[model samples]
Target: MSEGEYRVAVRALCDFTAREGDLDHRFTPAPSAREGIAGHALVAGRRGEGYEAELPLSGRFAGLVVGGRADGYDPAANRLEEVKTHRGDLSRMAANQRALHWAQVRVYGALLCAERGLEGVTLALVYLEITTGRETLLTERASAAELTAFFEAQCRRFLAWAGQEAEHRLRRDAALRELAFPHAAFRPGQRELAEGVYKAAATGRCLLSQAPTGIGKTLGTLFPMLAAMPRRGLDRLAFLTMKTPGRRLALDTLAV
Candidate 1:
């Protein structure tokens, strides 16, 4: 959230750099988001009293802030787990998906070792079947140095992209701060609408405004929003419309 600092979740970092091969969803229907959450809870409930569930882990690599909650950890065993929910045969899961799962858990392993000051730790992947309540666990032992090396490798691959993105945001924010209205003057009621939008954005409030046709509502609204973006530290702006013509109108307004 600061200058030169790029934040990313642990799973996101692995997905961007560790994934390989085609993305195939044909093996089985994926579990719903709600089901996945419940499955994780069920797995956590089955653990021993010494088990810690939803363990928050974080580490920094260069300018990137990486953080996520590991699914479970057992201090007694010095083990960290990453739980995944699935509905079908585990053998049928795609190889790339499995590889990505290992990549994520290994990163968690590196973080856990660093946090606990361990020379090595056991990394686990716990797969739970939603309907059957079946659990399959795969685990491996990794030295802190090895896991750290892997973690740093992934981060090194991602830092270049993060740097480019940071630079783009800097340039964009600078440009947006100097944005101006496209036309020489606002139509009747347009200036009021623009003022309302600018105030709402600057103060982090929601706004609703109505203006008659030909009041130049699109430009009036968009220009103020862009002008307010840098002041409010907004990362992105989106314009949503209900129909094709509305989309085209907004696009044309942006073009201006």
Candidate 2:
């Protein structure tokens, strides 16, 4: 947390900017979340004593925060890895997924290089199979400058979107601070609902409210959600409803 800093996770940055091509899960085979976690542990356990697992790392690119926990790092060997769990043919992975995986590791490599002040480092993708417990290793040696350049390119591609998001947040928060209640006064449970929404957004958590009808639910939720824009660093507030009528209610709430 610092001035002029745009906080972003390393995974988010790579997922956002490095994505291309249509979604094709036709060939890729992967394990469940729980299984993946176990697989990661298995690989980390097999590493040398000098290796560090779940290495929390971060670096900056023009105020954008790029951060992630690399699966493992061996300081002695100067290697960083991103562990992936899979089953079936690894060659079947889509090109887009491969590109994204490389992008993530490159950003991580740049972070590692910067943190260690090394001229270059080895980046690896360690894929472990859930069924056979076999591991596939893919690696590349990259200079710090090259990794930095790669990281910069990804950040640059996303910079404009980030800028617009930041600007929108400022405007939205300013409006919220000065926003007046749609009605002359609050309803019975509306104030509490609004407060809950604001606090949830501020804390970056979910809020579940259960109140009966006729409690100004629309305004209650929308108002505080808007008010929390700046503090929460929210790029957008999405209001999802099951039906068209509910969607209209949300839209009308905003218009008010």
- Candidate 2, residues 1-256, lDDT tens digits: the string is 5667888888888888988897663444558889999999999899889889999999887888878799899988888899989989888788788888899999999988888898999999888888999999999999999998998998998888988976876777787678777788899988989999888888888878898999988888888887777667565788888999999999888887
Backbone steric clashes in candidate 1, count: 0
Provide TM-scores for the models.
0.96, 0.81
Alpha-carbon lDDT, every model = 0.90, 0.86
Looking at model 1, residue 95 earns an lDDT score of: 87
Off by over 4 Å in 1: 24-27
- Candidate 2: clashing residue pairs, number: 0
TM-score of 1: 0.96
- Tell me, by TM-score, which candidate is best: 1
Model 2: residues with Cα > 4 Å off, grouped in runs:
24-29, 183-215, 228-247
